[model samples]
Target: MSIADPVAVREHLLAAAAAGHPLTYSELLARLGHPFTRPRMRALCKTLAAVDDAAQADGEPELAVLVVRQSDGLPGQGWWTGSWEKHRFTGDWTGPDARLLIDRLQRQAFRYWQERAPG
Candidate 1:
């Protein structure tokens, strides 16, 4: 929750994702109990992306959650599974848009896992 606590933020995100519920950036900020600002959002995104990258590099591909900035003329950002296209989570960087994106992402992740699950 503290501005200096990347570990807390990382853990919070992982837990949220694992809860089998959709999550939004606003919800994430509320969980952190931190003031929301453009700079803070940027920092949080950067930190999460770094953590995901490190996990991938460590051969924990399944645990990786990628954060990407959209550059195709879309005003949004997104997260992805190890196979990015298989489970992409995207949303505008503002307001209620993130909630919709999170919902879609959760659904995609659910479908992905279900398809891969052993019968």
Candidate 2:
């Protein structure tokens, strides 16, 4: 679960992706000379998204991504119960791949709980 060599995996994935090759879960792990469960791959997807600043930037470093209810202007501004509440995960959610994330990073219990709490 612990990604002792995340740098290597990241580099390999980037290289493979840049080479016009789409890496499957198994392919990615194989390239890393390791075997991981499917959940680990999902967690890696989140991890990659979080760690890669380029993926999060929108030409402005000052503005952080915000998630608002699609059905309403914002939360708690009014009695708006929106059907679509949007929030950026930002590598906080444990998701269904919780086990993998926990294995990689140990101090995720509180974060995972907060993500599951009623908003």
Candidate 3:
């Protein structure tokens, strides 16, 4: 699959959600048959935003919240400061507050997508 394919990425993220777990960028890329690189992650982030948009349109939680950093278990800066502004977190984008919010959002995603999604 292409690196920027939002559908492919959403499937992986939903699988993680079904497991009630989060995935690191490297892990996600590997699942997609690619290696980790900043440029690739950047492109992936865009697709993630689009995926989130669709989810929001469908009244679902942001699935991208499950795609987190390996070090912090939190979404990358792109998510925190992305263009999707309805429920955007405007704080430091890190630390306790951000963690709490991200955690809540991720749990919501997990709860919504953890239905053993068909494919």
Candidate 4:
């Protein structure tokens, strides 16, 4: 699949979710036959979020995608979790301030998702 192919990506994600097999970022990219890259991943994330919104209009399950940095000492070492239900994120943080910011963002995102109508 082309890296620009959001339709294919969304289809794969929905299939995986329906099969009870959620995908990590790497796994999702791999399934889409694309190599991992920051830009591609970001685009995919955006696309998946849009897909979730569309699905919401049809009363389909939402696809929740979460990306977090790892504390393994490797810069930019992170992974993504994608599922049909929202997942709470809690782990090492850059600092207390960063944690607070993340919390606020997460809460805002949750509310947005909760109140969004299919568009």
Candidate 5:
């Protein structure tokens, strides 16, 4: 039996997640042109789960998806909130401006977390 490719595994998983449905490792592998092998699938799922946990802890937004619509005679965009998340901001901004705002927010969050992290 051939070993599964981790790069392929990640890409498949990310694509599946982006498509709005989270798939288990077996489902991911099956979609990735392989009959799922239990050990490899387990290892891949563990690694992906750990990476996802770290990103969430660091406040890196998963999905980073923006839904846009017209509201009150202006265009607006916002993220979908669920569980522990809250939707924030509804202003219309240019693409570059949005990038700048997101970048600044990320930097601030990084610094704030660094200050709180144990050395």
Candidate 6:
């Protein structure tokens, strides 16, 4: 299976959630044992959306939001443009407002996944 498949991406997302922090795209690439590349990032983003779709259906916080840009430590263009009703942010995808929104979602994902993880 491709590393960018939802199941593989989710394993890394679960790790980030358990660690209580966001994971950079590059960092997630490393975890998946691949070097970073735009094509890879793009592929990952597609799978991430799928993961989030499933999460939304299950009433789970989005795990994809925990995958961020290494530069800003926040999600990229795709996430910024996606539809999110639970925790919407109308501000630009930077600055305090965006950070706050991302942080809140990441924290929610962390709590949800950590609680569900088998000890």
TM-scores of the models, in the given order? 0.50, 0.36, 0.90, 0.51, 0.35, 0.90
lDDT of 2 by residue, 11-110 (tens): 5544443342334555555565657575655555444444334423532111101111233212111111211132222332323442343232222322
- The Cα local distance difference test for each model comes to 0.49, 0.36, 0.85, 0.53, 0.42, 0.84
Ranking by TM-score: 6, 3, 4, 1, 2, 5
Q: Compared with the true structure, what per-residue lDDT tens digits does model 4 show for residues 31-74?
A: 77887787887776776666756766876555543333334211
**Residue pairs in collision within model 5:** none
- lDDT string for model 6 (1-112, tens) is 4655788888889888987888898888888888889998888888899998988898888898898998989899988887555556678888899988888888899898
lDDT of 5 by residue, 1-119 (tens): 22334445545544543444335445555666666565765554444444445546766543222111223211122221221244244433546555455445434444544454454
**Which stretches of candidate 1 lie above 4 Å from their native place?**
61-75, 78-119
Candidate 2 residue 24 C-alpha distance from true site, Å: 0.4
Q: Between the candidate structures 5 and 6, which one is better when assessed by TM-score? A: 6
Better of 2 and 6 by lDDT: 6
RMSD of 6: 1.6
Model 6 misplaced regions, further than 4 Å: 84-87
Error of 6 at 38 (Å): 1.1
Reference-based TM-score, model 6: 0.90
User: For each candidate, how many residue pairs have backbone atoms clashing (under 3 Å)?
Assistant: 0, 0, 0, 0, 0, 0
Query: What would the TM-score be for candidate 1 when compared with the true structure?
Result: 0.50
Error of 2 at 103 (Å): 32
lDDT of 3 at 5: 89
lDDT of 3 by residue, 10-119 (tens): 88988899888999999999999989999999988999989988988988788888888999888888887773376666677779988898888888878777664665
| Residue pairs with backbone overlap in model 6 | none
Per-residue CA lDDT of candidate 1, range 1-119, in tens? 66346677656655644554434455566678866676776666656666656655764333223222233211234343323454443434444654455445555544554554455
